[model samples]
Target: MPATILIVDDNELNLRLATRVLEKDGYQTTTALNGFEALELCDQNPPDLAILDVMMPDMDGYELCRRMRENPKLKHTPIIILTALSSVDDRLQAFDVGADDFLSKPFVPAELLARVKVFLRHLEVRAVGNENQMARKIAVFSLRGGVGVSTLATNLAAGMSQLWGDETALVDMAFFNGQSALMFDLPMRNTWGDLAQIPEEEIDAEVLNQVMLRHSSGTRVLAAPRSAVNADQISEEKVSHVFELLQEQYPYIIYDLPHDFSATTLVALDSADKILLLIAPELASVRAAGMALTVFEELGYPDEKVELVLNWNFQSQGLPRGEIEAALKRKLSIVIPYVADSIVTAITMGKPPILSMPETPLGALFEDLAFRWSAPEQKKKRPESPTDAWRRIAERMRKRAKAASS
Candidate 1:
């Protein structure tokens, strides 16, 4: 399909000339004699890019650009000021009103065509970079090593994507020896290692996208560097910037954080909407969870934002749940029973059980957890076009509720 370009000019001759030039270059043109007509047309069908004449009756291009930027539906559409005023001050003012580019009125036909193609290309790129606005950020952290942190994080991120059919970003905040990418069997084609050398200021949504490794399960993994030396090159500022960027595009951003309270880990914890603190059924793990809870209190994070999950990392007997809860002074929210062989096989194959075995008991548990931790919009009444995954989850939930009532 040809790119749609909205041309707004009060002068009929200029409108016809601009429209003809763009249409000749295989662009679909919509001509508007005034700003009001342009806005009305935009409301009806927003264009891919807009070309506006600065000099207009009642509303100038600057004002019209501002209005368009304020409209959520058309806010991201590229705006170019096509005007006779070629002064620096006029160009700056046009940009101040959110105009992407300012072209002089007496533009060379080739130059005009070139600018249109460039802006339309930019519009398409922006559309690709701007994904779903995921409002929640969940971080899975453990104060002790080998506590199933990565396993939980990977499954939660993948399961949320499966349950809600929304974008989920899994970040390896471990920086060193992170297995987030390996858990999904994704090759490290792009990882945080690539962004380590880039300036923090240069990183944004597009830059992040360049380094993310997409999985078949609709989860995007920002893996840590395979080498510790490369991992050390990544700055805390860069990790912070990546988190800010991910929050805008993914509904659920899950962090497989390192065990220590390093600068990078602290940034993820601070920005997390919910922290799933994982602890195993062991003395050392219980003690670590207690210490973590103390730190959370010191950080002034609300109790509700933190959930304790007990995973039976070992098959043998260990600390009981009651004693662990008493030690931490917080109730355990969820517990994962020992499924050692299955978990090991899944991890070795780089397929989380949530995606590989959705019909199994372990798979159902993770799906339920994903649904419970999802954003409010996902939990709202069934959408018009529901997926099989959503239907199965809804039916299972209804059955569970009925069982409880009985």
Candidate 2:
């Protein structure tokens, strides 16, 4: 069935124009000349998405949006605010009132269509997985330190959240000295320490939600404790329970693991849907990765469950890719090139490359990698309307395949 969109504008011509543009694309559109009529229409039948003009009689777009968000039936509906006001303050006010996107008045029809398509595509992707679907847990681990394990985990989590616009969890399992919160510039308001005192069976969704820190990129972080003593109080049982609860809440979870097979680390590794074993180009990193692989094999993990990721952390005196692959006896699924300056700057600014510099080579690489690790069901089926991020990744893949063929 074609998705329905509700267009609300006081101007008759503006309403007709928006309606015509949407209907031309096969979307069923209902028009309203005022906020009261829009609410009445919505009460009768809710739309999959809504386009609202900010300048309306009696009730402006901001109030209309707030009322819709308050309505149980319209709370999750995607809203795009259209207005002549193009100031940053106006855009921020629109967002504050729960608008998903903003467009200027006299907007290009193509731009409107593009934005609508993206929202609908996201809705379709979300609908594909119901409540029964468990989160895809990805654990980034390295037996050796300083191999950019935490860096990769942060980028992957942030990238996935940005791509899907869904809440992705980033669990800092490096409880002793995890920097996941710092990477995103989140304050350590609540952490695993908050959950440590609670009995494992007593920990529930509401409690977990309080402990998780929200990021602008839609990534919620389970930050490590500030004190080592608090970290030590977190037991393996608590970690297991937290993972089980997180799987129910988030569609994706990224684990930034410590450099040992500790009880807490094992709990995360054992629960992971996919394990990314990160290694640098040096011999020790390769040896450490090999040992980790052996342990995974011993633990009965399937070959496909664990993937090798080669990080070129150093600019010089690094082993070749072939040598590292030979030493580890596994093909590298992803290779992150050396971008020390970029990485350092991103860290210092409390931003991940994927969020701050998405157009840069490093940012694009992480974003693409995050998409590759998305939920299998989401990747297996193409969306009815592809999002811009999806199209960009698909185009990149096509170009790469073509180059290889030629």
Best by lDDT: 2
Q: What is the Cα-based lDDT of residue 314 in candidate 2?
A: 92
Worst 10 residues of 1 by lDDT: 118-127
TM-score of each: 0.69, 0.69
Q: Per-residue error at 267 for model 1, in Å?
A: 0.3
Candidate 1 global lDDT? 0.84
Candidate 1 at residue 64, lDDT?
Answer: 95
lDDT of 1 by residue, 1-406 (tens): 7789999999999888888888888899998998999999999999988999999989999999999988988765767888888887997788678776678978787888766664454345455765546558898998999999999999999988777765578999898789898898765756888889788888887677657766656687899987888898887788877887777777678889999999889999999889999999988899898889999999999999999999998998888989988888899999999998889999998899998888888988888888888877768888678756677789899999999999
Instruction: Please report how far candidate 2 places residue 263 from its true position, in Å.
Output: 0.4
Those runs of model 1 whose alpha carbons end farther than 4 Å from true positions after fitting are 1-134
Instruction: Please give the CA lDDT of all the candidate structures.
Output: 0.84, 0.88
Error of 2 at 137 (Å): 0.7
After the best TM-score superposition of candidate 1, give how far the Cα of residue 161 lies from its true spot, in angstroms. 1.1
